[model samples]
Target: MRRSAVLGGRYVLRSLIGQGGTAEVYCACDRVLEREVAVKLLRQASVEERDRARFADEARLLGRLSHPGLVTVLDAATSDEEPYLVMELVHGPSLADCCRGVALATTRVAAIGAQLAEALRYAHDNGIVHRDVKPANVLLAEDDRALLTDFGIARLLSASTGHTATGTAVGTAAYIAPEQVRGEPVSPATDVYSLGLVLLEALTGERAYDGSPAEAALARLTTPPPMPSTLPAGWRDLLLAMTALDPADRPTTVEAVDSLRRLAAETEPAKPGFTGRTDVGESPATRSTAGSLPGSAVVTAAAGQLRTTGLGAVSRPAGLARRAGLAWRWATAAVLALVLVLGVTLWSNTLSGRPPQRDTPAGVPDRVQKPLQDLHDAVEGDR
Candidate 1:
């Protein structure tokens, strides 16, 4: 559609914002509402009966859904020569663009994943399964809120939408679940698996499966998605569970939302100038004390001890480091105390006019025999 072209006599098409294999999305203006909206129109050349039906299905599905994390459908016309859908305009970039080959912070991934999972939960609750839940279909609003869009291949669990027959794969291969590759039936778990891949990609700055579409799709059948050990334990566990080969083993959308929200809350960044302890295992009193200490003091003490003692290179937890430092101090104190006691005894013998022993052990060097004999005599006298 040309720019300035009017659709449904109310929406005026602007410039093209996004293009997919089946449709082109344009930034359009709703003349009646006097607001900007997104217009997704099926490509004229590819508008067949199947594509038309799928477009209609998406409109109907989105029309019934109301969620902050989901793009709201404002208007749709499927009977026209070119079918189009008008939706609420999202102001920011797509999730794919936001994290394109760039790893996002763990907290950011958690926040986005939580929002997407919640949106998926709502859709699944309403009998909708978004078959294509890749990053491109997820929009990031100005506030960084994730809005799931483009339910073009979504299936209604209550009824069969003839566009996607049983045993037909219908999503992007890189983000699709194992079941999708095998052409098995799709469910909410299928969406969970895809979301897992999306989050993994966001965290790792790379696709879990990369190759030709056929190769990517087939790889999931035999190998599990990679969960790097560098990822937080919570993230690693959740991603592994979400991408489990068996759908039955994957968490529900509700569970995924809970886990993601928890992780997001837990991994939230510290406020500026915040001196509070980040370790959750610390007691309230311990945290309060640690927080009360000057930041420089804590850093200096830990770093100085670690550096001087050659323990800085050891990768140990804070608790272990503290224990090791304490042990080192104790051992040093014991050695110093023993040396002090021996020195005091030798000084007392010398002051008391007691002659130091002349005989030295056979192994003792002649140059140091006087001092060695004095030390040995002091120890024997003490015993």
Candidate 2:
């Protein structure tokens, strides 16, 4: 459709934003409301009963749901056998796009998971289940906030839209739960499992499951999802429980959010106002008191030992050069004493500024005495 076309008598289609299997979302101007909106239109061939119903189901479900972390659906209608939905136009790319080729910090991943969990908890409380919670389904704003979107595969608990199923698979393969893969009935745990995979990928550069759809789906059934060995202990524990094989063993949305919050708190950058800690590159000797140290103290401690930078008395680092400097000073004194003795004994007969004496040390060559004389002169001159 051209930009001149208008849908439902009020929305003017301007440009295409995204394309999916069942719908095309366009950036549109709301004629009646005088604002920008995202219009998701069903394809002409997809105007069949099943497709329209699914589109309508998403519209109705999202129209009633509201949260800071969820995209808002504004309106829904059918015009001449063509159905479309008007939604809030999110201004950023999906989490999948932002996460591509990057390894996110654990605290950041936890913050994103916390918001998504809160949104899911609200949906669950209202008798709705977001069956798909992959990275592509989340929109991230420029300010680092995440908003969960795409309710195309959501199941309404009230059975009004007829989405309930057993032994039916309906989610992305890489992040789908084991039960979903096995075509079993799904609950909130299913979404939790999917989010767990997303978090795993976010924390680590690699995904837990990789391969074609068939291979990825079948592998999780027999083999456990990969648990990252390098993550912090709290992160590992939470992810393990979230991706448990059994739905009952998995953490609830509330519990998962709590765990994420705790993980974030533990990994959060140390702040003077908050009672939290950051474990990045800290040693065991300083880990306990790292958060309590001042900024200058941190820099000083990292640069050297717990020594004073002239602010007070300090302990010197046990360096080989400093120890050698003390040893060299003592050795220089002994060498000076020996050189003085040799100089007086060897040059007694040719003494300057003194009475001549007929005495010279036996078996001492002039070659050796000359070097000692130069050394004694240099040492005395230096003093």
Candidate 3:
């Protein structure tokens, strides 16, 4: 698509932001709304009837669903020669980019997992199964909020679109669940399995199943995903259960959400000064700086920034730091006051012509007594 091409008579395409297997996403300006939005157009090469139906299905599914963790579909036109979808423009990188080759903090992983699980639960509750739940489909917003996007392969539980037939597996190879590979039916558990893989990758900084699509799919059927010994017991157990071979054994999205939230909370005490926000920016160069400072320092610095920006709550650590600083000042003042009082008392005795009291034994050896008395006299004279 050329720059400046108007779509649906209102969206002015500016530049290409992303290109997937079947669509090309562009940064566009909505002339009617006067705001920037992302426009996803079906690639010319993938303008077949099946692909068109899938694109229309995604638009309808997103329009019906509403959640903070799911990308919102603003508008769509699938019948025109240049079919396109308008969506909220997320200003950050994908989860795959954020955790490319390095494991994120445990707390950060759990928090992000919880957010995705909640989104999945919402979709499941509405009878939709997001067949594609890989890291690439998950976008991290500027504020570190994880939003699930790209429902082009999502299946409606109550109805069949006829595009995806039985025995035809349709998802990314690395993140597909075992059952999905068998060409069997899918449910919420399928999404949970994919999410488990995503979380495992985030924690280990490597794909659980690697190789070509055929090799990865076959490997999952025979070998279990390897879990690292360094992971916390809760994380290990949760991941193990979520990726169970039997879908029946896996926890529901609701259960997964609760477990993940608990896991996230468990890491909070260790981060006493953190505001629980992981600022994984749009690029690797702008990754979170929270790891560079102590937990308390991170809290203090974030609090200051929040105060200056007039955004978000600046309590807790900030308040604690202020109170501690005030107490330190008060303690120092009290010590100084006590020293001043003692000095004043000594000076007053000297000014009033009253000799300062001295502790001297009634009988002392002359040798020791002489030196002691001489030192005392010297001190008094100097005063």
Indicate the TM-score of model 1: 0.68
Compared with the true structure, model 3 gives a TM-score of: 0.69
Query: What overall lDDT, based on C-alpha atoms, would model 1 receive against the true structure?
Result: 0.64
How do the predictions measure up, each by TM-score?
Answer: 0.68, 0.67, 0.69
lDDT of 3 by residue, 68-169 (tens): 999888999989888888999988988877776567778889999999999999999999999878777888898889999988888989885557656545
True-structure RMSD, every candidate: 27.7, 30.4, 29.4
Off by over 4 Å in 1: 1-4, 268-383
Tens-digit lDDT track of model 2 for 1-383: 33237877899998877765557788889999899998887767545666677777888888899898888888888544567888888887776655554557778888999999989999999988888777777787777778888887789776643633344455644577877654567788888988887787677544565443334544454334554344665666677677765677678999989988887776543112111122211111110000100000111222112233221222331221121222332333334334334543323222223443333356655545654545334222211
Q: Pull out the clashing pairs in model 1.
A: none
- What order do candidates take by lDDT, descending? 3, 1, 2
Worst 10-residue lDDT window, candidate 2: 287-296
- How far residue 169's Cα lies from its native spot in candidate 3, in Å, is 0.8
Clashes (backbone N, CA, C under 3 Å), per candidate, total 0, 1, 0
Assess the local accuracy of residue 282 in candidate 3 as a C-alpha lDDT between 0 and 100.
Answer: 19
lDDT of 1 by residue, 1-383 (tens): 43339988999888877776567788888999899988888778656787788889888999999999998888889998778888888888776665654667788889999999999999999999988877777788888889888887788888854665454445654576767644578889999998998897777656665433334443455344644546666776787678766688788988898999898888544222211122211111100000000000111123213221111121222321222223343333333333323333343344346764445436544544554444445333322
Give the winner by TM-score: 1 or 3.
Answer: 3
Ranking of models by TM-score: 3, 1, 2
What is the C-alpha local distance difference test score of each model?
0.64, 0.61, 0.67
Superposition error at 162 for model 3 (Å): 2.2
